[model samples]
Target: MSLDFVNTYSQLINLSADADPSTFYSTEDYRKLQTLGPSLPTLSYPFPSAEANLVGESTIDVKLKSIRPPFKFTTELKAIPGSLSIYKLKNQLIDEVVSLKEAGICASNLKFMIKSKILTDTTTIGLLGDEVSITVMITQPSHNDTSKLLSDPEPELEAPKSISKGAWDKIESVLSADLGPEAAKIAVSKFKQVSI
Candidate 1:
């Protein structure tokens, strides 16, 4: 069974935040997370299609410079197959991070560098997609006494590819069978349609 693309991606993002970066990054879990990034455009599809079908591709690059104490990073977004105003999207992201800080989920050390651009006009009845690549690096804070000690090297381990596949299957089954068509439709109705 196939999972909702957006939900899967969202879950992956949350999981990454909760899991140890070394373990998550070294395993196939990270690769599966990358797959979710590319499907963003398709997942953003608005319901009740007009006479003309909209299609486009976008690429998002996220770099996590640090994940300890204070998170720092940069992101770049570029539309490849359609014209898109990314200012709103960028603002939304920053707002979310700020909200997290306000809620005490993250420290005030959070910082982001963002660059976005629209590339081309949308094409009708064509393929629309997005590719996202994320790089993560975790560093010890300068103020920490442990920073003076030698960093413990991550243990070499085989990447567990089946773990993610199993997770996907479990999530797909629940979403497909438990939600029901009506509930899913109602949920989708809540999101505002975006103009490509």
Candidate 2:
């Protein structure tokens, strides 16, 4: 089943001309909405290990250092997989972050961009090989005359805003009810990451 209710409720936010979202809304409603949405972050045919198949963590942090025009943005990800080109990941991450920012989900338009390179030494000599991955994140504002458009608080006025905290839980239930266990598990994990 789709997260029709959540989507529907979102559509009716501020009481639009659509269906009665209040009828489907609850303190735990946003969670329910996510439940009706699509499945994300799936593991392929053969199971992919969180280790080997797992690419190192890549994080993009945008810091709004000042409240002026031409603001600064810093994005940095440590322990990223060198095999993956930094430009590709940077571009993709920038796109996604910019989309979220434009959608008004992120805090502010003022942002800072920071980048870091890391190397991990791994050995597979014994019967079993062990891999350890570490991720580090840093935050700082920009240091220049800034003029960036801050995101409007339109999302705050939406019904989804009130239920965002419980959105993932409701979404998990919806997914479990619709998709199989494997898919639900993957979705739940993805949801948790976003929830954080």
Candidate 3:
């Protein structure tokens, strides 16, 4: 049998705290997270009507970033059958992160919005009727070192990608390997969805 999907999902649930996960909804912060505002209309995947439907509830995965605090975090969501909307689901995740931050369970970080789309499958017709589940993976700056910005904090320097490419690549490699090829690719894909 294929690797236990639940096991994969479990791993995602416990993704490392070093990812700087947090919930901040301000536009400026959201843009800094590299996300275009939430999709005009939140996507929704209505509960399947048939009881026999293989809803794939067990496959839903959630991953946190893998870097330390004093940073911002973004969660990129992915799904199969591009039509399967999960904007609300992402919002809920954001809310959870925020609550966790408020409770001191999680730290404050730059907030980011999620972008959702179906995976490699092209058959869009009735895609939602099939086994579809949404997954979230977090992205964050590689280091908490803001020394460069401190000396000359310019609007250009505010963007992390320009300053953190090398560090981000290293973290991405370690994380991708940890997630395994397939899952790692999915996570990376989600990362690109927002980053682009």
Candidate 4:
């Protein structure tokens, strides 16, 4: 039969039409109708819909870059699903890119940001967009984490530490600075929003 591939919607297919056990095998059966061969009858299939979906979720490309640091990395993570959590992306970075552990950065210490906004662990890649480019920053470990690396851990003092009254007064004065007459008003409004 003749291949009516003249239509804009169709092209000559090489693999199985059913798409089961998905694979490609260039056997003599598909030596091409162009070259001398027995022509198979063209079976017209329905036009592919614009939303002809995949069996699973589609993947997005993630581009991560660290502009400055002791640990600098630039890489494109391909075909990653948007549903992937920020935590998983960090692990992927460690696995695929730099030696993060050697740079004193664990997955927990990694920060993913889009411009000024930071991403939480629960944030998914898909929430960003079809493709995401983010800035990666490595944070220094917390005081508790730093203590663990010491050969001898310091013993806790019986009394809690207290700031000097003069220092406290100086800090309060700085907060009450007169950048303008309305500076204190603005600072108070901002401080009200802070949880602590």
lDDT on C-alpha atoms for all candidate structures: 0.41, 0.43, 0.45, 0.72
**Best candidate, TM-score:** 4
Worst 10 residues of 3 by lDDT: 105-114
lDDT of 4 at 134: 90
Provide the RMSD of all predictions against the true structure, rounded to 1 decimal: 33.5, 33.0, 32.0, 20.6
| Model 4: per-residue Cα lDDT at residue 57 | 69
lDDT of 4 by residue, 9-69 (tens): 2443432244333233546535433443234555678765545644456799999998667
> Could you say which candidate leads in lDDT?
4
Give the range where candidate 4 is weakest over 10 consecutive residues by summed lDDT.
7-16
Q: Write the per-residue lDDT of candidate 3 for residues 61-166, one digit (tens) a residue.
A: 3333423343335443334223323443434455656643443332122232223443332333233443433333343424555778798776654565442566
Model 4 earns a TM-score of 0.44
**Candidate 1 lDDT over residue span 80-181, tens digit each:** 223333333333344545533343332222232223322222222122234433232323323544644557655789765444545545554565577876
Models ranked on TM-score: 4, 3, 1, 2
- C-alpha lDDT of candidate 4 relative to the true structure: 0.72
The candidate, 1 or 3, that scores higher on TM-score is 3
Query: What lDDT does candidate 1 reach at residue 128?
Result: 29
Q: After superposing candidate 1 on the true structure, give the runs of residues whose Cα lies further than 4 Å from its correct spot.
A: 1-82, 98-130, 133-196
Worst 10 residues of 2 by lDDT: 123-132
At residue 47, what lDDT does model 3 achieve?
60
